[model samples]
Target: MTRADYVMPSNSELEAATPPLWSIEEQRPRISAVDLFCGVGGLTHGLVQGGIRVGAGVDIDPACRYPFESNNSATFIEKDVNELSGADLLQHFAPGDLKLLAGCAPCQPFSTYSRSGRSKKRGLDWQLVLGFGQLVQELKPELVTMENVPQLADHAVFQDFLGHLDGYHVWHSVVECSAIGVPQSRRRLVLLASKLGSDGLRLDTGDYGKRTVRETISELPPIMAGEQHAGDPLHTSSTLSPLNMRRIKASRPGGTWRDWEPELRAACHRKESGASYPSVYGRMEWDAIAPTITTQCFGYGNGRFGHPEQDRAISLREAAMLQTFPADYKFVRSGEKIQFSRLGRLIGNAVPVRLGEVIAKTLTSHVKMIFG
Candidate 1:
């Protein structure tokens, strides 16, 4: 496919197409939410698709503004989570609608604190998750939900977060993204708290089955290492070093450094320290799901990001697709140069759109049970 075959819309075009939140006609007893730490509208998009209304998205990054607004039709507020209050979120909800406050707080600080044995006195970064709880307490939003790394379930802060839900019935579980149609082996801690009643919310078993890498992206035209597809700039791959190119060529699907000839293997892999780290610098299996897409997933040496049959790592667009973003989803505006770092971070950090849709579906069912 060529660029002409798929023209990304202009910023103005997307804005004009997006209906203002305030102008949307009210449905009686409807559910609307404001997404906190909403990176590039993944959850918002899924919520919209699941038949919920999203009024706005709040995040600290200015770069998130365009994609969050343009794709989701929700107002994107560029502000830190700590700076926000219930009033800031309350303004976004339609009068009489069930207010749902949803967020995915950053978990990096927890990892940092865990390493230092300072889990109790966590820094400002750890406070962001608590800030979500703060908003919940102040707004008393009828429904609340949060998503994060599954490992967070073991943290003291996670327990602290639960303490804020005194009057709410809550349920949380680790959700496998592939079960929800995301073509990646991603698992997330999904939590739901409701003020409505005793019967707690639960996610329905997904029907999608495990989607595979080939199924998700095989239709796209091929591009070599460091080459861009003429039809899709986002389909561009990073250039591999000559040695790395040789390494990738020697690598096999689902295979590790063991698959490579000794000369093609990295020096680190030659050491005992690397013996336990076989998952890195490997190619994805065409029939299997992809590894967790990380911020550096565009790089050939990062995780199992190499393409199954192609001699280069997967492209930025492929990574987004594995994250369940639509082929036409716009991360950058038309003619804006696509930076691998910026786009990769935005896509990787986002809650998979499919998982968000699953959350929305669960919440919508709960709303119906209460109101109807």
Candidate 2:
């Protein structure tokens, strides 16, 4: 299969095509939500699926503007979160109506993997979380939700931000993505805060069931290395270097390249400095969930983004599905180019839609118990 095979049909074609397998009518609504830092509307879409009406999504990235609007049918404001005011958000919804403010601030600075040697001197990236705190203080919505890498729990700034919530009841947990039905082993810090007090905000624990890679992507049409699903450009796989392709072929499921013969190893892999980074140049196992998909998911060297059995990186659709986005979720619109940088950022940065559904469900139950 060639790259063209995986290209997604134009947005107009998809819109004019059959509707999604699941419809908005199937969901049960409880509250209105505003998605801040709404990357491709993952949380917003999931909230919609769970019956919450998302009023608006705010983010600075232009790439997210289209997918967020297209998929959620919500207005997208392309602005940095720092620029938003409480009054600006109030216009989206009327007074006396129950409102929820949800955000997943950029996690790079708070991430354990940040390459800045855990130094606080790296200032710019670290300020994004501060911006989120500012908005929370301004909006003072009835309910608040935040999702981020678990590292955020340990950050002093985050602690201070929580303190600022004052009388609001807050419950936070470091949730494993697999436990929430996202077909990845990603762990995130999830928080749900409510002005309704302690009894109103808690997540109910559920049995952790495993979701395998095959269950997530096995049904998609097969394509060769570097090819897109013929019917969906957004489902295309990344091109691989010839040597890397050979290396992937020799790789065992869930095994790192260290399992291969010395000749197959990259030069860095042979160095002492590279010993600690065993997860790079790894292959995913068919029967297990994938490792956390990160911003650099399009790059094979980033982590275990390789196909379980195929000799190429996972496609955009596969990544989105692993993140628990519905298969038919519209990404690029009609006449738009599906650039990997833009698409990958959207997928990598999104809150897993399944995770969002769980959150919305929990919040809905809480609201009903308190104010229904």
Residue pairs in candidate 2 whose N, alpha carbon or C atoms collide under 3 angstroms = 5-228, 5-229, 5-230, 6-228, 6-229, 6-232, 7-232, 7-233, 8-232, 8-233
lDDT of 2 by residue, 113-232 (tens): 566655664465457777777777888887888988888787787887787677688899998879867889889899999876566476654664888999899998877778877688
Best by lDDT: 1
lDDT of each: 0.84, 0.78
Q: What TM-score would each prediction reach against the true structure?
A: 0.89, 0.87
TM-score of the candidate numbered 2? 0.87
Question: What is the Cα-based lDDT of residue 352 in candidate 1?
Answer: 92
lDDT of 1 by residue, 1-372 (tens): 111232343445335543422223422255789999999988899888887899999999999999898888789999998888888788888654568999899766544213554554456656998899998999999889899988889978899999999899999999888888889988889999988763428986557789999999999898999998878889989999999999999989999988888888788989989797798889999999999988889998878999999999999999999999899888888788989999989988889998888888888777656544
